[model samples]
Target: MNREPLVSVIVAVYNQERFIGRCLRSLLHQTLSSEKYEIIVIDDASTDRTSYALELFHDAIRPVANARNLGLAASVNRGIDVARGSYIVRVDSDDYVNANFLHMLSIFLEMNGYVDAVACDYLLVDDGENVIERVDCSERPIACGIMFRKEQLIDIGLYDESFRCHEDRDLRIRFDKKYRVYRLELPLYRYRRHDSNITNNAEAMRQHEANLIRKHGLDLAASNGMS
Candidate 1:
């Protein structure tokens, strides 16, 4: 396996006019060689300045606008379909990751042969983009903000269109059951929290989370019928 890998950073945006530009700025300003990696941003039919904002980075970004909003998974799948890189990533439209996010994560994936996926801790930022707290999550089946083989992603049937949120968690659970997922306890992703952000929509987000858990039948205890 090669020690240094090229990555395709994918971002799916829907009605995120306020945060899309900032998110792209961080990705576009990465320290990695621009020639090695490229940014693929899908606007997903946002009814705002998203397309206009995307036009600003036409030289560095592959922006795709839909005739109508296709939701998250569909938009992401479209980008992945055309991704030329060996590795693929999913970055939320409303959040901005650290500059070294891809560089550090890719190096680790290259170093570990058994690791099928890679994820790191993230910084929680508020609506104003102020850092609220930092979480050092070191556990199995890491969340998104990962750099891994796109083949594994395809093998798992890609993102579940049934879920608008918590799809990543469900994907992780199913994927990890068959593969070893590694975690790097570093704040590489900046997860933004705002009234407009998906997670902050308490009612909807909770419903999505519950839907994921219920659909997967995540039971802790098993009943034995044998004597």
Candidate 2:
């Protein structure tokens, strides 16, 4: 019998009532084995209709609610703690995936068995769920559609909660230190871009990213393999 769920998809939500439903819908409709993957929705003390929307799929999806409103970093780590899958995925509640999102991701991870994480290309969607632009991130990996190995994360100390927004960047540096990663050449997600996106808060996000680099004592020479 197969003992491992291929992917554990975690979507951390705050007050994203408007987009969470669409995001969940995309995940539920993925052309992947429903039994071989699990979808985790973490409602970070959202004071919006996000919870009611989540209940619509509570029978199918796993929902975790926090006691108080923790930030995104803390919330996603919560999902990681309970994830039962061998491989993991971190998606935002405001983003949606393609129909074969998990299916394609599973294929790539299985293809590159030695890699600790897989990052795929994505499309930028608008509030109306219409594609505004296609973002090909195969050249540069970000967290939006990143697929990771569960054990790798546990060994490297999951996402750093200190930096509120650039947690993904921090994890990338750490993961790259000990393991290889694959940049899959598939566009398998619809990364919704809106005014409320965490990256949209340029100042705060940049500060967090800089701090993460400095806090970890990371240098360009090391990450780039330069002498």
lDDT of 1 at 114: 78
- Please report the TM-score between candidate 2 and the true structure: 0.90
lDDT of 1 by residue, 1-227 (tens): 43333788889988887888899899988877777687889888888787888888898888777788788878888888778777887888888888888888888887877789887888878888789888664432223487768888888888887777666676766676677567788898988777675655668767776776676664510110000
Q: Which segments of candidate 2 are over 4 A away from where they belong?
A: 1-4, 221-227
TM-score of every candidate relative to the true structure: 0.87, 0.90
Model 2 agreement with the true structure over 1-227: per-residue lDDT tens digits: 76667789999999988888888888888889889899999999999898898998899889999989888888999999999998899888888888888888788888877667777888777887788776667554557688888999999999888868777767777777898767777778777767887778879966875686586766742353210
Candidate 2 local Cα displacement, residue 80, angstroms: 0.8
Each model's C-alpha lDDT?
0.75, 0.81
Clashes of each: 0, 0
- The TM-score of predicted model 1 comes to 0.87
In model 2, the clashing pairs are none
- Residue 139 C-alpha lDDT in model 1: 35
